[model samples]
Target: MRALSVYRDTTGSKLVLDDVPEPDLADGDLLVEALALGVCGTDREIVARGPIWGTERPDRLILGHESLGRVLEAPNGAEISPGDLVVGIVRRPDPVPCGYCAVGQFDLCENGQYTERGILGRDGFGSERFRLEQDYAVRVDPALGLAGVLLEPASVVAKAWEQLDHVVRRTRRRALVLGAGPIGLLAALLGVQRGLEVHVVDQVEHGAKPRQTRDLGAVYHSFMEDLSGTFDAVVECSGVLVGEAIARTAPGGAACLVGIGAPHGAGTVNLGELNLDLVTQNKLVMGTINSNRSHFEAAHQALRQIDRRWLEGLLTDRLPLSAWRSAFDTSPERIKAVIEFDA
Candidate 1:
């Protein structure tokens, strides 16, 4: 199998051409042929960092989290059959308590975890062919289109909405999606579908800014250089230190931080208007990591049912796997860039 890999601990060292062999599998494993894979930010980050898959997570494992592939072989009792189109999720649940596998969240399981599959795991089948646990594989209808192929990330947005849905049942009605990136836009889409008065906030470009909100169906606002009162709820995906800003959620409102950044680099947030000292406040600040399988499933269905043409603009570029470096180094104006595999 020909795949891209990283040797030594450098993001730029991502290997593009290699004839790695197919992996041996256990009775519970399914071998998949990767057709198209999404290179997320971490795909590049891990390449530059010193954490080897096996050494830190998996010894010399492959890097890739959001990917779509075909099932070449399935073990007996596999949930998937050969030749099925499937999306691979990054997190796997341990049948037992693998620390961090808390109820309502199982992606954090640290023990008995597979050596492969997510971006930072022990093992990843980052090749034309790879092995995966049957349950981790999400089946997708081939008819969903290359756009439908976006179910993996779309499901992530679905998962974020699911979390908000649970909270809306009790409190909070409005949502402020804190970035205009793909995740924020998708989260905005789900918020609109679920009947929330959603507002998407981001820094603007000179001309292309208007179209982003026009397609999103959500009211768009620029971040607080034009400051105002607090929003009812917030979903911060701005990719900066948004945690503190999320802490400023309105009373009885909630804030969801969907963006990840460095440890000490967390952003500054003003709390005076959060009304902590001025009034009785009931705010909920939350954070979400990776999406679960249920999220992946729902995202596929939701995206399929939507018009998705606006998403065409969201996918600013499509590059071949060979030119992975160019795409990684140049991703400022882009929201979501895809790597088109063999036709």
Candidate 2:
């Protein structure tokens, strides 16, 4: 099987299109044929900096986390069946299985010992075929087709909204989503689905980001300064503007920070003023990443209810496995890039 992998050693690291052996399934694992894999910043970072978490042989790590596949074989009595579409859950609980992990809330792993597929410690679904434990594979609606590839990222948005619901006590009428990437757009879509007025901000003023935002019946802005009035809910998908996004939330509203921004060497924030605003307004700000099964299931439901055409629009680029290098291009016009495998 041909797999996209990252090879690292004491000398250095590099991306490799290695011809590896077929994965051996565990007792309760399902063998799935890869359909499509979503490319994101994390994959690019790993290609550039190498794997940070894995077994002794980090070089063996596969480099994809967002996955979509079709079951080729399943164990008897498993909830999934052969030919069913599925997405693999990324995080696995620690060996100790902390209090949160013990209850299946491994997304909130307390000990930082969790292993993430194609990420922290395990091989990912970045090949022609991969193995997923029955318990960690979530079925996708066949109706979604290739658009189902969006599920993994949408699950992250689902978890963010889930947390926001717990923090905000009042009715949410308006939402502000910072950044217009896949995560930001999906965040806005969920806000629209919830009947809130959605507004998206991104630096790209004349491209698909703004057009897609408008197509969803949400307003789009080129700069945060152009957005007027505070929102009951704020989703900061641009890691660079956490403080600004939080400041734009209305009294009693909450902000969910989703993006992991790059470090600004000498840049500083006025934490004292930010703290005062939060204290005086009774606001809440929180960060969320990865998702549990419940979030994936919720995201599945959300996708089912969305317009297929609109959902498909987010997938601006789809290339064959042979053209995988092109799929990594970060052009403004490209929203979500996918690599399709030969069936």
Candidate 3:
């Protein structure tokens, strides 16, 4: 089977599509045929900077975390059978098993020993075939088809919303999503689904991002300053606008930061005013990263309820594995790019 592998060391790093042996299935593991793999900033970063928390010789580290696959084989009595569309959960609990990981909340692993597929210490589903632990594979709605590729990213958004729900007791009427990338667009979609008036701000005034935001019946803006009035819920998906997003949240509202920005040196922030606003208004700001199994399941349900056409619009490019290099293009017009294994 052919797989995308990343090799990195003090010398340098490189990405190669090598012919690797098929993965062996362990007890409680499901053999999955890669259907499609989603490409995001994380994948691009790994290819550029090599592995961070990965193996000493990450040459074997397949570079995909967002995956969509079809079951080729399943262990006895597995909840999913052959031909069922599924996505593999990315994070696994550490050997020591932190208190959170012990309860299946590896997304919140406190000991920093958790292994993330394609990111930390494990191989991922970037190959033509991969083995996924049955417990970590969540079945996708057959109706979603190719849109199932969006599930992993959607899971992160689902977890963020879940966290926001726990903090904000009052009704959330309006939301501001600070970025129009896949994550930002999905965040807007969920906000719209929740009946909140959603507004998305991105640098681009035209193109798929703006159109998609409008398609969801949410307002789109080129600049955050153009959005008048504070929102009851704010999601900062653009790492550059954390301060601005929090500053625009209404009294008693909450802001969730999900984007990981480049470390281009710190910017100035007025602690006195920011602290006063938070203390006087009783506002909250939280950061969320990976998601648990429950979030993936919730993401599936969310996708099932969404308009299929709208979901499809989020996928701007689809390329075959042979053209995988093009799939990683960071073009402005590109939304969600996918590597179609079946193509």
Question: In every candidate, how many clashes are there?
Answer: 18, 0, 0
Error of 3 at 140 (Å): 0.5
Report the C-alpha displacement of residue 124, candidate 2, in angstroms.
Answer: 0.6
Backbone collision tally, model 2: 0
Q: Which ranges in model 2 have alpha carbons more than 4 Å from their true place?
A: 9-11
Q: What digit string (tens of lDDT, one per residue) describes model 2 on residues 148-238? A: 9999999999999999988887888999999899999999999999999999998887978888999999999998889899999999997
lDDT tens readout by residue for model 1, 124-168: 546777777776778887766556446766776776677766774
Which lDDT values do the candidates have, in the order given?
A: 0.66, 0.89, 0.89
**Backbone clashes, candidate 1:** 18
Looking at model 2, the pairs that clash are: none
- Order of the predicted models by lDDT, top scorer first: 3, 2, 1
Q: What are the per-residue Cα lDDT tens digits for candidate 3 across 223-264?
A: 867899999999998788888888899999999999988874
